[model samples]
Target: MQNFSKALLSWFDVHGRHDLPWQQDKTPYRVWVSEIMLQQTQVQTVIPYYERFMTSFPTLQALAEADQESVLAHWAGLGYYARGRNLHKAAQTILQQHQGEFPSDFEAIVALPGIGRSTAGAILSIALQQRYPILDGNVKRVLSRYFAVEGWPGEKTVEAQLWSQAQMLTPLARFDDYTQAIMDLGATLCTRSKPRCDACPVAHGCAALAQGRVAEFPFSKPKKTLPVRRASFLMMLNQQRQLWLTRRPSPGIWGGLWSLPQFESREDLIAALNPSMQTTEDSPASLVKWEEFRHTFSHYHLQIEPHRLDRVQEAPAEWQGQWHDLDKAAQLGLPAPVKKLVEQLEKEDGQNG
Candidate 1:
């Protein structure tokens, strides 16, 4: 254990990341925000979002007081709206329950929305300098290769073993540096592909490298083909040439974000619009049919087909959508697919005019 801690910390003193934005103050608020943004996202990708987010809502009270739309707008293009929503909800929870102070208790910290064991540990150790072990992706990779642990890390048995190993290796002194050092080692040297074994501090003791099976230590999950689903998006246009969009419902994909009106099929959308659309003014033949595209998720593939409905005189009150200028709509929180569709509309209008 001494060697484990010394080797990594020694390497970290020279090569570890020291100048991240969240590390400057090491406040619980900043650490929590950075950890959420870093989930399934690269360090480079999170820097800009973190900067803009801090600028907009610098404190927990500011985040709690802001509306959901405002929060989502700041998180636009980040590709995970739920995290932003959860962060806002957690802020409100902290003020209501914890008296606006970040809790040091493990249970209380983990109870916050969107924060798990690993994230809780990271915040407590990295920011507050408490002694806690984290098992994020980088740490998982490093431990798996160093000890040659087998099976997918997601498995319950494998996860338990990894947690035990992480806790065992975590030193009581300078845990702050140890936590960051292991993660930095995995990210920079012990990478998923093309690991720089020669530069690694623990390369001499790496079981996978010695056994010539470094790639197989962290076993991959079983592969299954993603199921395909279909939906029709009605690109309704009003007299002002503004697009009509609806705020998606929560507890589903793109929840709480403004998006195009969706129907199960083109027939369903047309049926809803036939009553108000004037055939002589805008016939089905004149309707522009944009090319279809697939937006792939982790478990499913969404086939999005965009259909144009121009000069829409009356909106279906049941749909509960509002009209917005294209430029203004672009500024709002729209999903990546919906945003791309808007860009496509912009290009088409420019060419036609």
Candidate 2:
């Protein structure tokens, strides 16, 4: 066994997390779901989501049979809606192509909608006991510091180097435990900030620790100011306290999720509500402009100005949306901001009543 893997395994045997929900079943489906959820998200945050999701669809076949909205509703607060959408698509694909079986082959697994190189490796190693190297965020951080690798890990060259190191360090035996051990090492001791080097099993050989630059390895992405974009969300509420919501088109931000009617500007929103600006009593003259808030995406900042239109009898003819009770609307597959907004509005409505 490689010294690195041996040390990691020793530590894992003594201190690694063994009781995680996904660890309990150790099935490919469970491991795949857990891996996908863990992408760019903390384990603590994913625990409840994972448990709820497992309850909703315990088996790959069950997930395959579920609707996209139902699957996404289970993933509403997890962010990265595309992961949820792709997961649902992958499950359906497996059902159709693999007869509801999680593919055992690496290439076949990677071909799935959301499974990438690292995720595929993890699923195979942890669930199938296959000997494959993973280069997930946690692994990258661990390997980068171990080798004192310099450069943003996102760069192709840097990532390739890390992959090679990960491949070299992965041992021939106990592949499952080794896979989980390295991830635990990163998540627990070799953390992004304030790493516990003293407790790190392989700290003796960590190049970054030797060089006194543990934080500098796995260099950050080149800084770029995230551009800010503005939009107006039209919260059209009717007399029954029902809000109009439209499903966003797929393959984009908040894709396949329900959201409030959105326009490029407040004028466009007003024009939609009162196209002719006639001075009639029910011309939506009392449009209430709510305070604007910012919702940051991975690439940009969305400055959202919200407008509330009340006492409307009907939705705009052009908007093909449904009017849902505020509480009921929160139950649908909604974007995080939209879900929070719905809950906030619902709470205020209750107080007012």
Candidate 3:
């Protein structure tokens, strides 16, 4: 275990990432934001988003004071809207309870929304220079292979074993560097596929590599068929060329983001556009059904059918939102699919013009 940490630190001194945006100031707030964004996201993918977010809300107090809509707008297309929401809530919590200071206590930090055990550990070790073991996805892969950990890492028992191994392997000195070093090793060398075992610093002691089962360790979760869902996004445009957009309700998919009005099917959309109680004077002049496309989530697939209603007089009484220019709507916090649709509409408008 001592040699494990020593070898990793030695390797890190030469090869570990040192110039990441979050690594510059190395504050708890910066690390917290980076850790949350890094969840289920690659470091390279997070860089630009993180830089933009920092520019918008540079401090915990700023994040707390900002509106959820603006916060989510910054997080648009990052996926996982809940993280952005929770981050805002947690910042407000800190402002109210912790006097706007990012909590340093381990228990207090984890209590904040979206700050789990692993994320808390990472912030403590990396930014605060505390001695704590982090077991993020990258570290889990590294430890699982190094110790030949079996069973899916998502399983509680398997995760516990990995946590124990992580605690034991964490060194007393330079734990911060060791933490970053191990994560770098997993990300760069012991990758999920075609792992660069030949260049791994700790490959000499990797149980999975020694036993010719490097790929077999860190077993994947049992497979299940992902169910598909269908949706119809209404692209209702007025004669003025402004599109009708609505904010999705919170505590659901794409929560806190502005999106095209969605319905279950074209029938539902048609019914809404031409409600039984409506007069012909309020009806849309033209209705066009665009092709359907698929937008996938982790748990399910959304088969999105887009419908465009042109030269609308007014939105249905049941729909609650505003109408905005297509280009301006695209600038709002929209789901990826909705954003694509907005861009497509913009392109078409350009062609027509």
Off by more than 4 A, model 2:
224-353
TM-score list, all predictions: 0.65, 0.65, 0.65
Residue-level lDDT of model 2, residues 2-53, one tens digit each, is 8889989999999999999999979999999999999989999999999999
Clashing pairs in 3: none
Error of 3 at 140 (Å): 1.1
Which ranking of candidates, highest lDDT first?
Answer: 3, 2, 1
Off by over 4 Å in 3: 224-353
lDDT of each: 0.87, 0.88, 0.89
Question: 1 or 2: which has the higher lDDT?
Answer: 2
- Tens-digit lDDT string for candidate 1 (17-113): 9999987888889999999999888999999999999999999889999998999998898878879988998898899998889888889999988
CA displacement after TM-score superposition, residue 348 of candidate 3 (Å): 60
Worst 10 residues of 2 by lDDT: 275-284
